[model samples]
Target: MKSAKAKATNYKACLALEVPAYVAFYKAPPEFLGDDALTIEVKYQGGRTEIQKITVKVSAPGGQQKI
Candidate 1:
């Protein structure tokens, strides 16, 4: 199997979501591998707060993977 480092450069990072929802995906640049995670914080109008975060992993070819 190929290693993540070898295939990392050929991949593209992206985030897609509908509006009015405070959900998102974050892909870090290759240089920031040590901090390979995405952080998202949402704040409501009434001082209420919500936060969601996820680790970013490299995706391989030939298989369907969900982000």
Candidate 2:
């Protein structure tokens, strides 16, 4: 029984929370990144859910690569 504008309507959340219904895409892997091994795909369109991975660790000095 927590209606009535939920106490004057005022709520907040953290950790980038935004995916009401559908819409979650981040395509950024085309900026002269030779070797071609860096890609981040986070898409959600309807049922079948299980997404929680955003890794990107590219160390310098000619070593380390996890994307």
Best by lDDT: 1
TM-score of each: 0.41, 0.25
lDDT by residue for model 2 over 1-67, one digit each (tens)?
1212213223364434433343333443545332433333445567555655555553544665655
List the pairs of residues colliding in candidate 2: none
What are the runs in model 1 whose C-alpha is more than 4 Å off?
Answer: 1-19, 22-25, 28-35
User: lDDT score, residue 41, model 1?
Assistant: 75
Give candidate 1's whole-model lDDT: 0.49
RMSD in angstroms between candidate 2 and the native structure over all alpha carbons: 13.4
lDDT (CA) for every model shown? 0.49, 0.42
Q: lDDT value for candidate 2?
A: 0.42
Best by TM-score: 1
